[model samples]
Target: MKEQENIIHISNLEIGYPIKGNINNTLFNNINLAGSSGELIALVGKNGIGKSTLLRNISGLQEPLKGQINYFGKLKNSYSRTDFARMVSFVSTEIVNVNNLSVFDLVSLGRFPHTNWLGKLKPEDVNRTARALEMVGMSSFSRKHINEISDGERQRVMIARTLAQDSKIIVLDEPTAFLDLPNKYEIIHLLNKLSKEENKTIIFSTHDLNIAIQEADKIWLMLEDKIAEGAPEDLILNETFNRIFEKSNLKFDKLKGDFKMQKSHHRKIGIYGDGPHFVWTKKALERLNFMVVKENESGQYIKIEKENNLCKWTLIEDKNIKEFSSIYDLSIHLKLQLKN
Candidate 1:
C-alpha cells in the first residue's frame, strides 16, 4: 500500500573517466536511477561494459563525470568523508591481500567511522562486529586468519565487514565471483535475506543472470550506451532482456527464467514420460540436436518408463522397438540410429 523510501537517487547521470586534454572518455551517459531501502538490486552487463565503473561512481569512490546523486535526500557531495562512510559501505571485487589479518580485526575496520581518532573499539562496536560476523555465518572463523580460509569464506568476511559498518546502503562488486556453485548460492541468498530482514539497501554487480533474475528485488541492466532498471519480470515482459542478451544461437527462456542454447535440427522425436526423469530426458534429447515433440505425431517416439524406482527408455520407430535401461545406452543407440 505504501512505497518504500528511496535511499539513493540519481538523475541525468553521466559516468566516465578523463582522458587526454581533460576530455571525458564516456562509458555511459544520460542515466537515471534510484534504489529504495530494503531492496536487493543486481547490476549485470557484458565484461568491460562499465558495470564496475558505475558501481564505483555510486559508492562515492570516484566522481561522476556529470549529473547529481542524492543519498537520503541530500546531495552525495555534501557529506564529509567520515559522514559518507557512515551512509554507505562498499565491497569491491579486489581480493584481500592481508598477510596476517584476523577476521575479527578486519571486520572491526568497518567501525572506523564511529571510532575515536586512535581507533579504539568500544563495547558497542565489538557487539556490532560479532553480529555482523554472525549475519554472514562467519562467527566461527572470526579468530581465523583471513588467508587461511577458503575464497568463499573470505568473501563472506567482506560482507560481514559491510554489515558491521551498519550503513543504510551496501554496494558490492562481483561478490560471487571465484566461488563454487554452493558458495555462490549461499552468498546470493545471504544478500537477499539481508535486504529483507536487515532492512538495508543492497546493490551488487554480478555475472550470474539466473540468480539475479530469481532472487533480486530489482535489476539494473547496463547496456552499451545507457542503463535499464526495473523488476526482472518487467524487463522480460518489455523484451529488454531479449534485446540485450538474445543471439542467433542462444535465447532467453522466459518460462524457465534463464538462457537456453538453440540449435538446428532435422530429426524429430516424440517423447512421452512424466516427472523429473521426463524433463531431463527431454533435455538430453534436445542437446543431441533432436527436435523433441510431446505426442506421437512424429514417426519416431521415445517412451520413458519408471518401474520400482528404476528407469527404462524405449525407442519406437516404424515397426521396430529398442529398449535400454540407462540413458547413456539409449543415447548411444540413438546416436547410431540418427547419424545423418
Candidate 2:
C-alpha cells in the first residue's frame, strides 16, 4: 500500500531453526516477502511456524538455504557484517548478554555503525544516542545498569538502541511479550508513530493476533505447512485468517475480528433516512439484533427524520416504531432513552 523502493526483499527464502536436536528441518519453503520504507508489518505465525526464522533472515542474522535476499535492493550476501549492521538493527526475544553495561552504554551499541575503528563516538553520535534514549522514554535511566531495569524497561532500552543505530530497517522479534496490556498498546502505538515520523521500515514478529489485525499495515502469517503475507484487511476479507489458524474448535469471525464460534443471527427491522443519522441508526439497530428496513416515502405515511424535522414510517405500526429527528438530536435522545 506504500509507494517506495523495497528495503527488504526475500525471493524464495528457506529457513530452519539451528537448535541442537533438530537442525535439518526447514519450517516452510519458497517464501517471498517485501518490506518498504515507513511500513509497519506484523510477522505472525502459529507456534513452531518459523516466524523467528523469518525475522532472523530479514535481520541478516541467518542465511537462507535457497533463493536470494536483497537489503535496499542489494543482495544480502554482498554486504559485509558492518554493511549489514548499518542497514538493519534487531531486537531479539532471546536472552541478552548485557549485564555490566549502563543503560546509556547498552543503547549506544546502536551507534556502532557510525563510530570510528575504535568505536569512539563523536559529539553528533552522542546527541543521537541521547535522543534515541529519550524517544523510548528511557532518558532518566541512562546512568543505571541495564540489569537493574525490569523486562519491559529493558525491552524499551533495546528499542532505544535500535533508534540510535539509525538503520533504514528495524526488525523486532516478539517485542511485546514481556509488556502488560496497556504497555503493549503504548509500545505498538509508539512503534506505529515512529515508523511514520522517522520514515523507517519496521517489521516485528508478534504473538498478539488482535493487535496485529488492528494495527499492522501488512502481515506475514505463517500457516501450517505454508505461509501467507499481505495487508491485514485483504487477508481477513479473503478468509486467509481462518485458514492460517485452521482449527475447527476456533474460528475467525470477520465482523468481530477474532476467533470465535461460528454463528448466524438475523435482525428484521426496516426504516431510515440518509447520511450520519441513518448510518448510526442502522448500526445501533444491528447491534441490538433489529433488522432495519428502508423504503420509499412518496405517498406513504412513512417519514424520515432530520434535525428540525421528523418522518413516520408507514411500513410498521407507529406504536413499536423506531424513529429519530436528526443525527445530533438522535444521539441525545438515544443516550437519555437508554440511560434510564
lDDT of 1 at 145: 91
The most accurate candidate by lDDT is: 1
The digit string of per-residue lDDT tens for model 2 on 1-340 reads: 4347568888887787555655656777888878888889998877778888888888888877667888877897788878788789999997465668898998888899889899998999999999999988889999999888887788888989999999889999999998899778877877888889898899998888788888888998888866678899989899988886676556888987887554343435455467665666666554544445545322222245544555432233445444544434544544564467
Model 1 lDDT, full chain set: 0.89
Candidate 1, residue 58: lDDT: 88
Best by TM-score: 1
Q: Give candidate 1 misplaced runs (Cα > 4 Å).
A: 1-5
Clashes (N, CA, C under 3 Å) per candidate: 0, 11
TM-score of each: 0.93, 0.73
TM-score of 1: 0.93
Worst 10 residues of 2 by lDDT: 296-305
lDDT of the candidates, in the order given: 0.89, 0.77
